[model samples]
Target: MSYVKDSDGRWHTIFDQTKGSSCGPTCMRMVVKMMQNRDLGEEQARQLVERKNGVAVLSTLTSENGGVGQMGSHNWGNHGHHASGGGGVGVGAEPLAAALKGTGIKDAHVPQIYARQALLKTSLKNPGIAAVGWGGQWNGKRAQGAHWIVVAGQLSNGNILVFDPIYGIGEIDLSPAIPKYRPANHEATLYNKNVVLTAK
Candidate 1:
């Protein structure tokens, strides 16, 4: 159910995320490959986060109560696909933009807010992939935190072809609402924050 067939009858590969906090790097890695025709491995993409953020890979967490927390820096929940967390940790809008720029994607940027669905479709048709900040769950649950996923392309039926690092590849119908961060009837949600790279 996660895979979809293309026009030429090829099924898209599902690049699932290995850690709860790795969605950012995972999506970025896919974007780089789609844009430049170069494959960046998981560790390499994590290192890219370190180089861009100017911080060592986050392997340990310091709690506010002066206690050392286990696993990654922040708690993004330990889901099935997300094993023990660490390495490259997490990324925000600004840090994600910086990381993309560091990868030679000079025009990479995170828009101030969500753009129109038409514009989003247009971006998907561009020369590269887009990283969407999602806040909903596959089960249609509303989440407080955001998740990163790649919008690979638009399906012929008007559904969005999404490469969710956490949930795998699937198509979803997005709402026409402006800030499409809220879930409607328990479906995939999207935040206003997005990291898009239209150029190599």
Candidate 2:
């Protein structure tokens, strides 16, 4: 469930599953389970899960189910058929949002796209605040879709706190690397380091 750097300079994590089930469902289940155990209210749970690492879990869930589907294909009945094509927000975001809402958080289902825009707009209203969306590219081509991230807060040391769903629980210095799915020519990638937030 966590990434570790091995002697081979590669990242690895221990994975567990029952009955060949995918980790996506299991991970979400764990999050929900943890929330219930703590008796966290909906909004509080939403904020907690919206932390840097929580978003990463959400992202993984979406990626595993195929990128979000396009338009009409997003309907549950049509998911499998159009999922392969990829365009709309995948099945993952809404459910996660809904779960957060169930905990009493309203509007938790903010789409990644909307989050990106809101981050930018909100930052513009505050000088010295900024936000950016950073992600690896397939070679020189932009990745098919946005991998949303938020950079917030300035520590006394001048370092920024990054909130990323794809990264883990803590603040990580950003870097770029090729994604697993791209063709070799597209191997050179930008890291998820773009500033999704900045001061106005």
> In order, how many clashes per candidate?
1, 26
Model 1 TM = 0.64
For each candidate in the order shown, give its overall lDDT on alpha carbons: 0.50, 0.29
How much is the lDDT of residue 198 in candidate 1? 48
List the candidate 2 regions with Cα displacement exceeding 4 Å.
1-96, 106-136, 139-142, 148-154, 157-160, 163-165, 169-200
Per-residue lDDT over 108-133 for candidate 1, one digit per residue giving the tens place of the 0 to 100 score:
76555454442354334342233333
The stretch of ten residues in a row with the least summed lDDT in candidate 1 is 59-68
Local error of candidate 2 at 49, Å?
A: 12
Instruction: Give lDDT: candidate 1, residue 161.
Output: 62
Q: Write the residue-wise lDDT of candidate 2 on 1-200 in tens digits.
A: 45544233334232222211122222233334333344333334334333422323334323333422244122222212111222112223444445444544343334334333323332211211112222344345444332322333333333333322233322222221222212122221222322222212
The TM-score that candidate 2 achieves is 0.30
lDDT of 2 at 132: 24
